[model samples]
Target: MQEYPNYQDIVLVGGGHTHAIVLQMWAMNPLPGARLTLVSPQVQTAYSGMLPGLVAGHYRLDETHIDLVRLCRAAGARFVQACAHHIDPLKRRVSLLGRPDLEYDILSLDVGATPARDLPGSELAIPIKPIGHFHRYWLQLQKRVQKTRAPMKLGVVGGGAGGCELAMAMAHALEEQVYSGRVQIHLIHAGDKVPEGYPLLARRLVARELEKLGVSLHRHWPVAAITEQGVRSASGATLALDQVLLCTNACAPPWLAAAGLALDTQGFVLVDEQLRAQGCDNVFAAGDVASFAAHPLPKAGVYAVRQGPVLFHNLRAALTGSAPKSFRPQKHFLSLLSCGDKRAVAVRNGVAAVGGALWRWKNHIDRGFMRRFSELPIAMDETPAKRPREIVAARGGVSLSAMRCNGCGAKVGAEVLHRALEKLPAQQSAYLLRGAGDDAAVMELPQGKLLVQSSDQLRAPVGDPWLFGRLAALHALSDLFAMHARPVTAQALVTLPLATAEITQRDLQQLLAGAVYELNRHQCALSGGHTAEGAEMQLGLTVNGLADPDQLLEKSGARAGDCLILSKPLGIGTILAAEGMGEAQGRWLQKAVEAMLQSNAAAADLFAQHGARALTDITGFGLLGHLLEMLDGGEQLGAALIAEQLPLIPGAAQCVERGWLSSLQPQNAAAYAYVDNPQEWQKLPQWELLADPQTCGGLLAAVPAEYAENCLQALRQAGCTQAAIIGVVTGAERPLAPVHLLRKADWRELIAREAETVQS
Candidate 1:
């Protein structure tokens, strides 16, 4: 809890349970002058303990997860959802899979361990240790079981705890179905005992559970090779399995070994008592992925959770000028395990027992752990910490706390941008009124008396040029839909990270092609713009559309008593922020990206037909931030939103509950300072997600109250799955910063019903 005097950056590289706890501690007692950043590939971190429950249909996806985005946001850290591909120790940079390299003064890694797959033909095998991916595969197995009623044999490699759990869970799930007896379960381990590493009593308990599930167990056998048909054991025994799962012997990520870090013989990062890399003080490692020379511990969630407090302290100490603290890992921690049939067993200090109450206890503990991430409250520290020395040096001590002015200030620094744009020429247009000076250039209309225009830009957090181009193009077009302007012509401004000419060309082509695709979808002409190599990646656009002046849509057109409609769900901002940090889940990330890539043209079309009054796409700013713009344009107005009614991308609210939020989330929350009780806002996980800034987000349009239902129906029919009638505009209820906030129960019920209907 001690505050450091100098600003330093602590970059955590996973969204594991340990890091989630670390974030919570940091939120309560922040290290002054330190900027915390989390990198992960998922916005939602699955709780391993609940995997069995989830498989058994006892727990929901939202029940057993951590919101990496919300956790980072609550901790006042930047969350980047990106996978770590390599680490440059000399450069102090962590290079991502296909994004920009991240610079950190001090780094802590808790990315967890994966099952070893170095055996021949391992690619044909399934890994059960990565619970989330395995969960999806398990779902496929269910479908396969149903499709083929013939006898099917399931093989599990590695008699460890994970393998035992999966075998039991699979047996329970498959047996409950009509094809129960047709499904055969086999458990193979290199050792004689099931759950070999646990105490004798615990091992015996698991064995009994497997016996009751009618699972066949093989001992002292290792797989020599895995094939499409089956696996070959070293003992010269061949086992035919319809599905084979491997869940033994955890190994550090391959990238870590290639990154040149000092590792153990097994390839885990070697760390000292304080979790600092054995030979590198600036880098630290932990979880199942790390090996400690002084105190080696098994890869267990309990150990990871216990290490959090010590890791947080040591990380700050390493950045500032302080001695490292020792992390004394316990010799034995309690292990509460499930048997996939509402039954459980507890293993602690060599004692073991099983009972129904034990399962309840386990569920309580897991839910409690998840609740920490799901029910976080937001309270910003008024006194901002000073900038880090590196950032100060980069900025020459210039102020950077506030947003830069738009017109000239938003432009790149004079010397830097001038040289880049010099090679590019302005477009020659007879109707061009202005080129590049004011907020946006003025362009006269054609004979039809209608004009179409759009603008967009992206500050790169992660990902490569190709993906960035597509995202930028989609973002730029949001404005055209907001104004209900017809797509006609478009241009782009691309800024790329410095690289060779070959890289530049590839970047430009992909970037523009992405823009071109969207423009062409609307039949708009891709005229031209500007491109330049720079220190980082940024893309923007100035688009033009055509419409009668009288038909032009504006934020000022919202009227009192109108219904507030949101065309898409919130949470992309938080998810992307988490993705940059490498804490986001791979599946959740795919979903977020898909959502961002979708254009709002369909929703806009539906809203226009529904008597849309005013509209603006929610971006950079959050829901309340954008809503205020609509309400305050003329006479003051208030809004009563059904907190549950607001449409949100799946898992976003859970991320908020876990305290995962965008870097802009706190800022958006600050803009919500007008709200009297922010705690009330915290109850609505989705409402808290409203502060999550979106990339290519949907339009927030005001529609006539009379046509609200019809508008909603039209939107649904037009394929706007997330569209919803969130609330109604109200007269101003006294002057306050929060002119709008959520009404929890109503919103929650509506959304729950919406989810069920969609599922049905």
Candidate 2:
């Protein structure tokens, strides 16, 4: 079976190669009755095979990294971008940083070795093990160098393969990027040879290449401490340096030392040949984080790549109650080492070769490996259709869709609702006189305040019910927030897929619990609503709010010359649509999720305080449609938008460039019919984005030109990082029409021509 309402949980703790391969394989062949979840702190995992190429500027960021979010989407797994802080074997729980703990029936660890070893003064220098952090540091370093454009000196503490490659790459790139500034690089090695464990010939070739690239190499110089002045060597010699990086030996993450798993001398998990933890039946580990008890091997990605098939086989065996297979270390494997330029050294079985041809071959091999991740795509699905074996047996082997009941019989049991509500934290409310137990909730409005109500629904965008519930709840409450109303109470309307009793109970518990978590934050009480078993999982909310009539904002009172301000970035719809098709990168989805989770309440308050003339929330209608609504169908008013001024989500531009748009995008584009020469404007990259629908998007407001700058600052102070002034309104001429998109150059040219006409 390819799908099931999971009866067992399988959690993977890292986004390394082993787990990535396992996910792709799972998509091809899935194990029934098991749910897959990946907990990783990063959405993108760097491929070590192409790290040298990336440093050399031969490959782009996307080429050298795997998108974990897309991989999880392809595998039908729930992805949680968080670090695992601790593991409790007895309780079968994994504690996470900044979120709730996860319970697992089976757990796999592939969190690669950490480079933050017990080196003295290591904090003074950047450690290069966590690739994500290193990549960020690398980007910042480039910007700093470009900005200052001054003579600089850089040092690498350990002359391992990583150190040598980066030193050479930096020297070569600086010479090209900042020709005016002289840059010197130094490679200091504690060992006699660069990359101590490698062959002598390979070491000699790497040294020759480093010399050709003008990278100075120092052998047998172990740094004792890093000081403000420079790196102090064991021989009492100090080398002055502007920046230092540590490519030191790798060790297990510090948190693993306290975990209850058996570990080796270096704190790595001890596992059998089958990749299963020693003396543990339900836990397994792979990659550099695990040490095979049968034999010792150097930390390499190839070993993890080799372990993928065995790990997959053993995991399925464990879940299905069958025999498992063991993994064997390859006796001889080829090694490719790249120089800063387009040249590499290949070594195998006492023979070594070096040249640009070797580099091309290495590039081909690396890209081939990465293509496996990019090529896998999945079909969009609303929900898992299959049920556990027990459910099938109980229902006479009929599918859940065929066996589902109708009307009253389909309603969730009252006992289940009572049980789910009991776990919720208390929320005291003065507005709600009665809730839950009666046929209807009775509420009272505050004295002299106007009542505001809005309702919204969304199908499951993610497999994680808890997260989906929170997003859905926020999305529903956005309407009231846009109108400057204070949320007071909410009624949930939930539709859950038919499943076993236990599965249904778990779903409701997680879903409602997440919804209440947000409601409690907003001081809104969850009064009650309805739930029914349906074909798919969905969430809706009917929110009631309170607002002073004089202070309320609306979408119809816009005057000419008003400045248009958007509180949040665009691209939520594009990323979600691409993610559903398994075509989006994990980093893109990360930004989309962050934008969706933001609340527009603060922005609304700022808009009202700054004298906003018109207000609307950018939701399912997209930016253009919502803006048109704010203009009251643009009957007597017109607007001009600066394309370059629009704030966008990180990966949104790329998604639109790739034509990944939501299903509602075409309908949203209908709003552009009100504009002049809309087809000509279609060539702009921001076109599809303006038509991209959003859920829980930002507040779009028309404010006075004088308040625009002050309002923007206020929004930023309140944590609206992407807020910006997008455009202005112009209502004098019918020729101006309802809308017009002006690129920066065109806008400047138009202003020049208008100034000339005024002078005439």
Candidate 3:
């Protein structure tokens, strides 16, 4: 994925099938000088076609969910994991939850509809509009069935095809998975047929299948109200069921109704043949979120999947002033509804069939469709980007782009810098003599205390400037935390790519807001520092703190019996590297982001309170590099670690095995010189993780043996969930190799190995 000079923006506002396919297509044929972004509440989008199979235990999670993070990376798009709360067509901006509004040149909406909540007590009933939320509830239901240790009654509302399939699948799950309990599943419909729009033959076949599977059919029963016990029909007949799965008619999300777009009676966006929102040329819509006004089609996954290519082409056309293409849905398409047990009922053009063969065919088609996103082809265009299209005009023919001059000429405009400074997150400190806008910050030194200071810098890794700012500040603050100091004041040094005055101000404001948030967490005040235009985004922080001489910690005081504890899990570096290459899954990247944003203050304080012998924060050189530095504090003290005891980030092992690593990994390998039998150890994923570079990594401490367990409990209670005891300090047995890396899963085995090594 190459970055070009961006002039126009194309924003996709969902991870639905249509947008997923569009991303896949864009990867193969992207427009130059256009910026792309995706705003989605989820990292993975469920494939509705195979959702029933997934619920029935025939398909796994990965098979039915598409990784939006990977697709965005492949398409050179910025992935924003946040829900869109409002869209302003007139202003050309979309407001997201807890973030700045995103401006767009062209926007498209494919966010699927939620189940209509028309009647009272609908909130009590479990709506299956969002499949992701429904899946979690399903897992809980399975456990509830087993926990009760008795027969249960489950009901599915809506006699539509989705409801019918889900009812049968629920019955099958009870029979196949849970041995301790049985479930009596019921399907309720107000209509004459289980599937409303299908052929008569197809309806008859589906009814027979439901009967054979022992699903109770409540025909002509429209739900009037829901109660604590169960569902009540319009005729006042109530079914006292344990739970209800609502698969009623689709309705637009509440926010969409106020988006100022033309909508149908159901509140869904109205679109013409080209899928462009009516009266809004810059806006487009597809999938369940859009109601085709010319020819109203049923909300089905097949139509959304088919409409993807046309939508993709038209979006590009809109950007380049080319003629747009129109999408025409077929009058009738084949429908394959999964049965509970490896069988499916197929309907097409007044013909219907039921057999196990249909299920196999459906599975093959669904997998093939998924492979388009899972296995993206390699591209040959690795050329360096030409200067981006100008969003702001250049001054005197001097192009202001990724390439800018060095020295004072590259300084940001005074007006842009002033506006950016005024909007920074609130900061206050009594010791600061001057704040931002000064030549340099003047700060009073901490009186009658040991002054602690540290500095750290890194090239921005994540796409979001705000997030990168937050992570960078926390990374720099960890050094002060590890020393058991109270952070007081800090200065920010930022290097951003050259852009227009307005764009620079916006970027700088977001970045500083995030940085100040982290600084404020430690009661640190933001002073002033340098800002310059550069080829890329980067942040550096210089922090000043005060420490009590008696409580101050260093990496040099560990004894032979001290225990080594890590504040967080390893393997974050690998996941980030894989995401950059478009090979990492969405869930994997989410976990990495969460880990990097965590503050180390809590864990450091806990270690200090528990009488930690030595402490250091791990960073670019990896765990082993920092660990070696910690060892330098003592006299030839050796360390022993259990390989399997080291915690790993999700997907880290798979990524490392596939050769996904940060560019700094090779340089960090210099720490491997301390490992015994380096050639043999290098074969394991753990070996690479030991040398993997982390951005906002965690604190590594050596605590006394008696205090290790209590310290761990305190850390977790304070939200250091991944904190654990990984290794222990020991006598200097091997002068050549002081670190003993053993492949043992148990603590006793590690102790036994140390004993044996000492005796030998």
Candidate 4:
């Protein structure tokens, strides 16, 4: 009888070719009860095969790139856009650049090797291993070539296949652009031959290709250092060149060797025939980043690609408590290399060089491989309804959708939270008129100045501590700014997760650094607060701000006909939710994080300068919910919102389409039911997206109709480009129309009126 595969998680740590194959295979024939995840720094993975062709101006960037976002979506794998810092074999976790530890039952490492060998000033020199960086550098070089009409001297380090190809490609490119045979290209190598490890015939073909491209080759010469002049060899010989490209022997990222995993002499992970890292049953590694201890082979893409299936099967075997299948790597594999200008060189066993037709054949293979990722679209197969027994069992636990508690219970669910906030009553003082409850509570001044106090807490559901800290500081300061008060002092509340003493200290230092950086930027003096131990990390701030009685903008001053303006785009909550599930794109998520970190200090300053009547920052409560609160407190004013004019972050509509909403979305949407056309309003994507909750979000204010444009202009100059007039205030009626929803036509008219008024 076959053993049933138990539920397990198989995490692929990189978006290399091997992992791409793994994702495709997993999508086609998924292993029962196995959860798959792919983690990388970017959503797009460039096909190395088409990279040379791209540089030669044959293929467009998108044409030569595999969309990891689309591929992972198709595979039903969690795709996290983050850089891996290290692995903790003992803890069965992989640490990330800007997020929490990702635990794995079975981990596969297919992260390709980087060019990090011992070359002096290597940090200053560019490494060709990170193709993303190389692409940017190459573009810069092309612009330089176009701008500088003088003869150019370029140097290529390493006589390896990659180095040779880039040298010829650069030379060919420069020749096309400059029309000057004055461009000189030099290839420097520590080895005696161009393809030192390959058969001599293969070397001759590559040598011929290099000569054809007019690349001068220097063999048996090692570079000791790279300088502005050029590469300096160990024998004290320096090759002069204007630009240097380093494509030396590929070495594993040094951070990997220190990750508590068994490593070979060259610092690659030591794996058995089964691709399992030595002495670590749950851990596995592959590609150029891994070395077979028993039968070590050269770092090559073919081996990495071959290991994917074996790795997949072994992972399933490990999950189901069965014996793992071994991967016996072949003694030799076909090597198809690209020469500059759409030509190629193929080497098989003892046989050697072939071009033209062979290059076409290689091109077919490369395009075919890329099509697996690019051509296929993700179609999520409907999950079969859970059986009665499983459904019953799932209902017994605390619901993931349970109503959140306030104060301490207001914290995120324990399972999801990095750390819990400690609940403590504010310290009592005679001078303290109010503590942490109200938005900018009143406080007795030390002298003639009046003080306002407010506080806020944030539980990070996703992303890193530094990012969380930045958002936390901004969130805390929003209360002061919303009250038209200048921030003066702040005290931090920190709750750290379970970790080693040293790690805890480092986390605290980093978290504080992030917070201090934001606080200092706004000139808020750092005061003392509290810290404690918890299962998850959290941050909060208790802040004091100063305001004169006459200039203060409370939440209660809106008059009838005041224009309602929102000083930032909506959908942060949707983005945050997507980020938690690893469903967000890297660039979009980066923008959201940047927006969250931005201080409303500047916007508030402009609001005070421009004579705002009333203000409130949009936070956990949706925009509609916050607007309702302002309506209740303001001067018997009702609101009529122009749904069409609302600003939103990109991808927010898709998030809503996919049912990715903030946990608080339901409550916020319910709050909008008071409006007559709430359902009709919900039909509009922007209005529907407005129900998304935000953390450290933008401000909403009631300004005079005449001054609204000036206020918006002030906001733009103050760095609030997303700011817009969203609605207008109205006199409260007997039926109590506190909020009115405008139809699409009316919304368009409101926006036009605002634009025309601004232009006039």
Candidate 5:
């Protein structure tokens, strides 16, 4: 049976703690007619409650973060990995950084706050509010501290609990390291005491913990300027520090005011007791980014977590024409502050208690909260309700079943496909020979030029039809480029899911518009092919090009000493799989998509100019799979791949470690036996990624060692920044396997020698 289309949309702007809860709730009890969408820049959002624990090394990154990608999948929401650049309340549209505007019948915002950077020299200091950015910086700082022989000074600015907790955790972490004695931490705050706003007893307990940890506290120190040298106080006292971490007052994103919404003086979205935007009936705000005008609350994680159920209920009510429920937050909530050394202080209503038991209790509460999202229930595949007898009869009594197949399973009706093609623009090139309305395209070959043909097909990997079409077209053309061919003509093969004539026609038009856009860019004309009905969407293109017979590149042409070059980064396969399972960040998926859509024509031309001996595009088989194909029958010829030199797509390695991979991964990985050191390579988390399948992937070219650097430089100049000489073809003598995966150190001397020769 055909699934009913979603008629209304509910868009969530950020994957904050509240929205994570909403997604969990929605997954369990979804509103039938509403389609949910989440727009966020990250794949995983850090849980503020676990920040200190993560810093203290009590938990891993994945354990302390919510996998927004996977959560969105479980919630059946369209997860767009992009930042909201602007929101037009009047038009009900939210503009994103690099995608189309999203229209919403109901909208919710839970974008958390960032640390205020108003102080002079704040630019040089790392702000800890945007936890994602801070986490990355913290890792790099940790590595720097561990490697330095000289004494290292770290300063934390802000007397609040967040700042204090971070200082203690950082000190605890450094103290556990091998060179812990050389690292010193200083807590600087404008207030006279640390843990400001907490109960007196809580403050005393925190001060004692700081003293025990050898953390020096600088009170009543109003920082006037920050420089690379250190922090400067208004009283002319300067503290020299190698690194400065800011955990100051919260600041709202400036975009809220620019969206024309009523906002508080501090730039937070103004909301009423019902959590609805002050002036916009269809909009709602929650969490730290929102300021409740009736009863302003501290920007804390507890408040955000409590607002989750209220926001979920109000958003659904606002969409369903029901009265919104008012949210009354408790005046005082229990606060547990960790002391970074397996101890914690609990405070409420001016009373306080401290002990190791309190720390254990805090850990249980935080982990229990994380378990809610981390151990989410697997969402069952929903079956569409059966249509009435009369309705089924009108459609010729077709069988009704909810299960739908993907790939060829989602092709459009042949009749519908034909009608759509009849309306497309007619082909205008002489090489077309025969165009649309034909079973298959037949193009005339240019005089004295060799014919080059390549075909590629794939199930829809993205939700946007138009964008998917462009990517599919670009992917199909990559093979021709690998063979050093110039585009001439192309044929389209499209499959679409069951839908009404109007929708089918519209989707077909949009899909072709994207494909034709890319084809036109390469001076290729679309002749025609076939279309059919299926259970899911799929697109394919059979592209033909012209090339000089003698100049064409082949996969079997590699010589023994040629340097191997990869035109794009590895990990698209793993990233796509992670995204499908909702474990990848939106920014990572966006970057992968952009990389997939990039044309390989320029890289191919550069490789050919530099005399590439052998070339092939890395696709379904992956880098190793395609490389093995190049080595198949060549006697005594093997390749050495520097594991570290391989350019990786950002976030790919993390996804692999989390066990997210393509369905074809097992089959691709079976080829790992061809590597010399299988056991050692397999132990690395990034090893499985080598076998992960790719779509519209990069070109793998083997060029003379002398010209490899020039080819790589030209590729980068043409926009292939990740291109690199990953390895080189080796002589037959060292043949335990067809491939050798070596560490970077093992090949550094060889690479240096090659670099000198290239310069000569």
Candidate 6:
């Protein structure tokens, strides 16, 4: 492992082919004092070279896509799963759609292009760029064609290699499903012939292949508009089609034009031969999004791949103040086009050849390129190169020759922490008598009000210190919300890894800033706590709130006939655990983080308005454990949890099925003994998720049966999109069982019984 102090930040805007290559290279030979950050909208980026094969059912989704999340982890880079909204070149910051603006000393953009959608009724057609979205739509189309026996008409726009290849691929896929005779396929192009830019032989071969596949070729035709019935060409010629796919001229993202960067006529960022953004020394651009001003090249994946090594070299040069080498693209390159079968056509310069052997060669090349990123070199354990003794002494007084401690030995020095604390802003409150300096913080209580307290701590699940702190504070505050109390103050308990005094102080500031930001959002004052060094990062918050005696909610007030409402989705525990092992996608973890950061204050108020009888925040003990606490050996009151109705995070069920669970899951599963009628529900993959411990989870409340729907609606309107009425409380007739697991088949019966009980 490599470590650097006070490193410079390098932010990569997208996980394109070039950037993906750069990340892998950096992992092998990392810059000594540079930190890398990758910002991408999707966790998996598709390889364009293999996309035609994927459409033809020759490849699986996972086989053609690179997992950016796992790749970043292997590269020791921070992965921000968010869309890049804009760039501030003057300020050196990249603004994301739903997160904070990322500050960078160096910035790079490798976001690929999308099809031109400015034509009339273009939104009605599917664009092939932004490959992730296209792949999902393609899957749905495949399922639709397979299920229905009705005839379908499909049109492909554009005469280039992509458009031609896709038309043939779609035909091949439909034929495989035995719908070839019923489905009509059209390849529409503005040019006079298919494969317009290819050699004469390649063009003739592609034309012959299209004819063999029974695909109609509409030459010298440009689409004027797309309607529900069909496509209307510029010459008043109309073609009836059920669906249209546009593989027309690729265009730069709209955000690039809005960012005020120097762009070419087509709106792509202009870059020099060295791949540096024109007129911006600290910025670089590559892939389909960049236009090489000196020697222009076609917007192809091959050019992007060729530019990777140069971009990587130049980026390092910019960071270390070295001269960058120029990049010169070859005048001509070989192009291999898959014929939607086991054969391919290879064209280079003015020569062309066709054979199954060519297809195999292309397959080997594409797979080998993908393997560079997918199968990264295993990291080896090697001793650090010896540094001067004086340099080691200046850093922390530890000898460079000595091995670092594993546990408490990795903690920071007490004197170092004390010095860091002096630089922090003073946090004083009317409720706090003595500030954070003493052994403990002292606080005063308001007259005639009850004190509500809750404490929570956890090891950092994310690499960002600020994000971890914010999550920690939110986790603690969730308890106050469940109790229907107003948060007044909080004390932080932070543990940081051993590092230099400068690095320690910097991390401390970021951690506290995040915690304070969340605390101040609720008008809660920070009353200081304790900080110490540790083997790993951990953050804990002890929150104090004020509650009115008459309005306070408790776990003991749950009634037999109440409706059980969960304010958020479950399965976050499984998601986090999967992420730790690099088995989770970036998008799933992103959703989990957003859920954890949401404050439960509004949910609490809504629960109270809906006449909730009992409330508790789900935490480390899992939903079953917390619900069991409410049951508490009551003989006359029991609960029924509907398995299908439970709200779950997007990929949680899949993770559970894969046996990815939190370390504390076994302890929480012990409460299964309290369940009376498990039935076949216990065999479900989601069954284990009930015992999965959550961090900063949602509130579980019991409300009147009649108001359940209304409460759920209000919660959804208030942005708790996953909120659902999972089950209902039942009157216990059998004393031996207090909990019941209801499957989908038992839903109607349970509802009928509840209705009769209410009527009685």
Evaluation by TM-score, superior candidate among 2 and 6: 2
Put down candidate 5 lDDT per residue, 1-760, tens digits, no spaces.
3364344568899989889989988887776545678888887899988898899888898888887767877777767767997999997888877544666778999998877878998989989978977889899999898787788889999989999899989878887542355878999999876798987788998999998887889998999989999999988999999889998997998777799899999999999988889989889888998898877888988888888898888877765566778888888889998888888989999999888999999999999998888666544343434333333343355434356565565566567666656655444666887777665667778789998999999888876566788889989999899898988888888877655554576568657867887888888889876676665678999999999888899898886778899999989999988877656665587679878988998888999999998999999998888998887655667888887888888888888888988999999987787887776567676588789888889999989878988888999999999998888876644565778777664444555654554456
Model 3: lDDT of residue 673: 74
lDDT of each: 0.72, 0.82, 0.83, 0.72, 0.81, 0.81
lDDT of 6 by residue, 206-229 (tens): 988888777889998888998888
362, model 3: CA deviation in Å? 1.6
TM-score of each: 0.63, 0.90, 0.92, 0.67, 0.77, 0.80
State the lDDT of candidate 1 residue by residue for 627-701, as single tens digits.
888887777666667776877776676667767788778778766666545665666776567667888888898
Best first by TM-score, ranked: 3, 2, 6, 5, 4, 1
After superposing candidate 2, which stretches have Cα over 4 Å from the reference?
1-4, 146-151, 175-182, 382-402, 411-426, 433-444, 500-506, 633-635, 730-737, 740-760
Q: Judging by TM-score against the true structure, name the best candidate.
A: 3
- Between candidates 3 and 4, which one is better according to TM-score? 3
TM-score, cand. 3:
0.92
How many residue pairs clash per model?
53, 0, 3, 5, 16, 0
Q: Give the true-structure RMSD of model 3.
A: 3.3
Model 6: lDDT equals 0.81
Model 2 agreement with the true structure over 206-266: per-residue lDDT tens digits: 8898888888898988888887666998889999988888887789988988888999999
